[model samples]
Target: MTVDRLGYLGFDASDVDAWSRYANNTLGMMTAAKGKDSDRYRLDSRAWRLAVHRGEADDISYAGFEAADAAAFNSTAERLRQMGYQVTNEPDDLKADRGVIDLVSVIDPSGVRIEVYYGATELFEVPFVSPVGVSSFVTGEQGFGHIVLATPDLEKSMEFYVAGLGMELSDIIDWDLGPGGKHKLHFFNCNRRHHSLALLPAPAPKHIHHFMIESASLDDVGRAIDRMERDSRILLTFGRHTNDHMYSFYGITPSGFAVEFGCGPRDVDRSWSVVRYDSISMWGHKFISPE
Candidate 1:
């Protein structure tokens, strides 16, 4: 089960128009209509890296994990079946919709829909030009970026992702929330971009805590901060994480989940040793009130 990278993400939002504005005007992503009710966003050469469909869920609908090739994809599906999980070979309609050659769908312990696929549609001829002049996003081998999920059962979630999907544990953050007690967040990496997925034991209205998008330039982050502030969408102030050391800020997406826009995250290398950190961020990340 060699999952190469976190490829693409899909969300169900109540207001697709609001999401379109957020992705285009604020996040600086290029967008294309998936159909009548869905819109897909592009971060790089890939046809689409993120999508929002008109729905009331207002949460992550599915997460697509890329396999290195067709062999790896088949191996992963077989491995999941051997592990007693029901893996479904998705239909051609879905394959065409996702712009992938083939894909298999499975449910994690936390009930998050996971899609593993290969041969994603690439558009190298149509160079990515950010709508708001973001310069470029940190994608390519690292894929679209990271996703933080709030799981009811953290241990089972870990087993499904780490053991089942073959993701390597990067580090853990033991955050103390005073009256809220201690919360442990587990980070896992499938590539060099630190953790592509993180799990936190908590109860939330939504399945996702947030999904991150990294920019190639630190200046892009600065400009994003300005836009978020102007629109009163800042959820968490600027900060540097203890583990990945990503210089970022959390902004409220139109769907109600947070989106971390950042730059300059330290990579995970062979020398990386897993360690527990007492805090989530070294500096800021203060909670901002919409009041």
Candidate 2:
């Protein structure tokens, strides 16, 4: 499981219109193309870094990780089957949506659909237009930011991501859930972006708590919140997080999902520090309630 980077993510949206508005108007991403069932948003004008598809439920569709080459993609698929998990050649829609030469799909122990692929289709002609008339997102260099998903089996999910996918642990947060004696939330990083994915214990099988995108600066994050609240009447947190050190907040997407608009995420060199686990959140987040 030698994943090169976190390639892209898919969302199952019950309301594509809401996501369209949220992605285009609030997040400052460019909508490169759209169709009746799905729409693609450009984080760095490489076709799309995020795809939202019309569906019956609003949830995370899948997490796609990049393999170094076509051989690596096939090898991963064979390894997954050897481990007693079912793997598939990339679905028709997935292949078309990602514009990849080859891909393999498997469900993790926690039931999250994971896609491993090589050679993503890119667009040179598509120019990124900031929805807020600003500059651009800090992707391409950092790749996209992190996505947090809820899992019932926290420890096993951690093993799958850290050992199976080759992501390194950044830190772990133990939430004081009253009588529960502090449940666990783990963060893992691949590229420089803080925590490409996180695990949260919840009753659900495997669903995203929220997915984040890195903005240019703190001011860009603030402007996004202001516009979302004033014009769209959508409300959420406006505070900085302790873990990532991102001055950010969460708002509901049109798909009835949460999106974290943030900037200034703490990056790592990987070689310098030993993996650290901490108890306290970097800053107090009063907006998002603990469940």
Candidate 3:
């Protein structure tokens, strides 16, 4: 699958009001629309980049990867069928809301939901309103953002993402929580924005850790942290990661899940040689939640 970029992501949240507030106040994203089933936020000129839906639980609902073209979209659907995964095309209203020609949905071996789509509609006439005065996110050039999910079947998930979906392994970190504590986490980068997806040491049918959006500068990252603290939403350490060099901190979303606000991620060069490291963090972030 020649996945060029991230299409959009779906989140299941109970408190839509909180989500809307956090998104506008902390994340600096504009609300495109809200409905009975879901709410959409726009990152740029495109219709929407993130969708929040009412669900029984708070977790990542689905991930949408943008295909290079309609051909790729059709091919991905066929490939999913060959792999014995169910696929579905977006309904008419959904297509209009998403601004996509079509969306092909599938569930991986770990039962993670994913969608592949093409032809994103955009309105060049509309000016982008940066919520919270956030200058910009590292999106247009790096894709939308990255997602980290927990999965038990690491090898199988790896095969599906790397071999099947065409993501490259950027780095792998073996984590030791404490004495006799060890865990293996791998990072995969689809575009230049470091790892667009990461897998944690867990079993199948796991919850999402958090998703990241790029900040224009380190100052923005610090500002977000300050805002989160002032607003009583701070969730974790304000530190930098060694892997992608993303200076970030974690905060509680309105949906009751963690959100990573980051900036200045190390962009990868396709021609360069691989540089592997035993650790992913140099300093700052000393906290890791198992929830």
Q: Write the per-residue lDDT of candidate 1 for residues 165-251, one digit (tens) a residue.
A: 889999999977667688898999999999999998977789999999999988999999998887648999999999999999999
lDDT of 2 at 162: 66
Alpha carbon lDDT of each predicted model: 0.91, 0.74, 0.76
Question: In candidate 2, what residue range of length 10 has the lowest lDDT sum?
Answer: 272-281
TM-score of each: 0.97, 0.88, 0.91
Candidate 1, overall lDDT? 0.91
Query: Model 3 reaches what TM-score against the true structure?
Result: 0.91
Q: What is candidate 3's lDDT per residue for 1-291, written digit by digit as tens?
A: 567777678988878777878888878898886644788888787777888887767788888888878787787677767666678876878776667888777786667788888888675677668778777777774677888888878898887777666778888777655663667778887778788888886643336877888878887887888888766466668877877888888887776667888887778786744555666577776564534
lDDT of 2 by residue, 25-58 (tens): 8777788776345788888867778888988768
Model number with the top TM-score: 1
Task: Please rank every candidate by lDDT, starting with the best.
Answer: 1, 3, 2
Choose the strongest candidate by lDDT: 1
Off by over 4 Å in 2: 91-93, 177-181, 231-236, 271-280, 288-291
Ranking by TM-score: 1, 3, 2
